[model samples]
Target: MRVRRCRESDVTTQIDAHQHYWDPARDDYGWLTPDLAALYRRFGPADLAPLRERAGVSRTVVVQAAATVDETRYLLALARDEASIAGVVGWVPMLLPDTPALIGELAAQPKFKGVRPMLQDLPDDNWIANPELAPAVDALIAHDLTFDALIFARHVAPLEIFATRFPKLRIVVDHGAKPSVRDGAAGWQPWADGIERLARLPNVHCKVSGLATEASHDWTEATLQPYVAHLLASFGAGRLMWGSDWPVLNLNGDYLQWHAVASELLGALPDAQRDAIFGANAAAFYRL
Candidate 1:
């Protein structure tokens, strides 16, 4: 990746806050079905190297796309080997009795920064807030591991409850809380409201990622600006961070295309503030 030093004091380095790598042949990602043929094949560090370079991303946090602990282990191994991957957001069996042990084992590894439950796939929207999972959540807090909320807007209310229940636990809402951006203004309010409520918690952060894929086949900077603006207003640059959402982003837009769009959306902000959104906030949040 091309390195450009920013002169502004608050402006520092650029990091891709969120991205993923998957080996379908090695791991069973049920979501990686043939219907999504474009992403069905292997996506490793080499596959993402060019995209990161094209987008000028200096480092990245590789997140889990599968629910298995084995997948998390795979990512952790990659983080150890790949220079560009600064952190790994691995998965945990949230409902299992032995979750704390799983977290402890993974947390022993240097680059295992956080854990994410596939909340959107679970039938119960209230799962995160369930008291039965308190030990697991507490284990994450104890280990200083972040909780990556891989959820849809419907899961946001429960997420707020979870955040409130554990105030000091670091939480980041992945993919702008993944609103249905194709809905335009009429369908945007629920996600906007949820994000606003979640941001009220000092400990919660939001990712300005994955918007392009939520829209229909034809999405543009204009189509995504309103949602981006809402996140800026809700989270502020200090609490917000940028992510390519990469291979998934390929579903709607290329890596550089999304990067350019994100830059355009934040054009009004001062360079320092934009730097926080693009890089600093994530570095601080994930301890990269």
Candidate 2:
């Protein structure tokens, strides 16, 4: 594992709620094929610490970039060694009978905070609502683990059902359900409606991250404001948090650029509310 100097917690406490690390040499990142040249190269904690310092983000939740346990283990090791990575959202075989035991084993680590399945990549859109997966959901609730929903707009309907069944479970929606920014206004209503419905559930939270990548290549603050505004209105500051999305943000933008956009978008709110959206809410949700 590569270790780097990290920010002292006393000096900075902004938490980046979502980011990822991947090394093709170590694991096969199927989604990160040659077509994604910008993100195809290796990314690890060493590459991120400087960006974190530049953004004034002292800690982060390193999410799984691949579905394999090896990838999760890799992230756990980073969380173990990298002070900037406060917690980890690792992957687990949710449908398997041994999932509870597996979750227990992972959670035994002090930095293991949650689990996130590659839901968007799965063929079935309604997989989150599958009754057969109840045991795993129960395990998460029993262990006080969080669920990072890496879903798309189409998955919102089933997510509502899943939230209803597990009302007490903590869940933070990753990337604002990844709206159809490419379609512009034509794609707003469905995603907005789904987000609003999900927000009605008291347990769900939303992350203001990854929108620039969804928009056109030349996206601007004005281009992303509507989606950001909708998320703020739907989830409120208390239930919303900000994330840099790090190297993934490199596809469309960079850490400081995304952080600046977030600051500009939330500039209107009171400092307390902005503070919650930027870091406090994430700390509370992931129990960092």
Candidate 3:
């Protein structure tokens, strides 16, 4: 892991709400192709510990990168040994009949806090909004587990429908629905509008992560400022959370760079609000 000295902040309990730990040699990560050379190898807690420690991040919510229950179990096993993992947002076959029982078993694990369906990779933008998946979604609510919506801008509307349909399900929009940062200011319309609409739903939340990858190769903090500002305006500090999106983040930048950029972008906020975005909100949202 690469380390950079970052200026300390007032955040006492920093939690990276969206990150991953995977070993392609052991698991089937369909997306882990050789083309993504920078991320084709193993990435585990040992590699992340020093980076997070250097950035003053004490805990993390390790989310699912593969669309398999085995991958979820792999993360759960990792969390068992890695104390810094506050929770594991594992995967469940939501469209299958046995989802409820499977969820019951996973939720019994103390660190299993939620589920993510890899929505962005699916062919149907409205896949998550399917009424047939209600049983699985209900099971999440029954177990007090969160639902991490891994989506893109195109899926925002369907996500709104899903959120409204399951008002009690605590849903956090990973990567602010992945706005079109590469399009620059011109790409703000539908994405911004969609995010604002999702914010109106009390149960919906967003993450201040992954924007660096969404922007151009030479992206700077100024390139991300407007999007961050829009997120703050839409969700406020209470509903937003900070994350590293590490390993994948390595494609664009390192953990320290993202953390520093986030701190700089949010520097103007009062310490209390900044604290919430950095840690408290994730603690509350994931019940960590």
Candidate 4:
């Protein structure tokens, strides 16, 4: 696949909705156990700055990856200091009793635009089913906060229940529901089954990021076809958005490669649709 070369001036704006930030020294990332030590490198706004500029993405929403409440507080504080960071999606231990009240306190911060539970890290399939987490999930809805899901495809059943249970919450699925492209479309059936179910929820949206990493380390656009095509077909341009997943995506592809590959996929679509995939959908979805 080839992307038509265009002058940077001809390209319009875009946003990296699924990007993340962390200052290991200034903050805690003990979550990066030695098992995932390679990911322990420093990554913050400085690392993303060039990727954002290169891809013509003026604004970005930095979400939490750390498993701590202080991580949320840290990003909210960072958002206040950075203009390029238009929004922040931090974590809150929603299963706890005071979740609703605590979220009420966090929402007053202008940049605290959304919340994400560490769904991928859960050991139980019914974690979202917990009665305690229900109101906590609802707390985000009550405060008009966006909910960004970090679940893998295998956990789709529970994800479906959560989305259905809280129809009022504006949910965005990250990483194309995390297709196992590395497995050479190894997990397509299950991921697709879950994605289709998740798509049925009109309130839920999806962001196209982290695809390169999911595929084989040496993946091409063709390697990512099954998942990418399904996303476009499932969510269409209106419900889909784009993100670089940056420094992390560096493990798979650089910003320019991601830019080229993503543009190749979208350029094949109608101009209006490409606009929506690139930025319009995210701007509207996150109210950025």
Each prediction's RMSD to truth:
2.7, 4.3, 1.9, 2.2
Tens-place lDDT per residue, model 2, 206-271, is 999889888888888888999999999998989998887878888888777787777777877876
Per-residue C-alpha lDDT of model 1 across residues 153-205, encoded as one tens digit per residue: 78878888899999989999999989988887777877878888898999999
Clashing pairs in 2: none
Error of 3 at 184 (Å): 0.7
Q: In model 4, which runs have C-alpha deviations exceeding 4 angstroms?
A: 1-11, 33-38
Of candidates 4 and 1, the better by lDDT: 1
- Mark the regions of model 2 whose C-alpha exceeds 4 Å error after superposition: 1-12
lDDT (tens digit, per residue) of candidate 3 on 1-288: 224333455787899999999998974899899899999999999999999888899999999999999999999999999899999999988989999999999999999999999899999989987999999999999999999998887888888889999999999999988988999878987899888989999999999999988988898888999999999999999999999899899998889988988888898899889899999999999999
Candidate 3 Cα misplacement greater than 4 A, ranges: 1-9
lDDT for 72 (candidate 2) = 90
What's model 2's lDDT at 233? 90
Q: Would you estimate the TM-scores of all the predictions?
A: 0.94, 0.94, 0.97, 0.92
Cα lDDT listed for each candidate: 0.86, 0.86, 0.91, 0.79
User: How many clashes (backbone atoms < 3 Å, residues ≥3 apart in a chain or on different chains) does model 1 have?
Assistant: 0
- In lDDT terms, which candidate is top? 3
Cα TM-score of candidate 3: 0.97
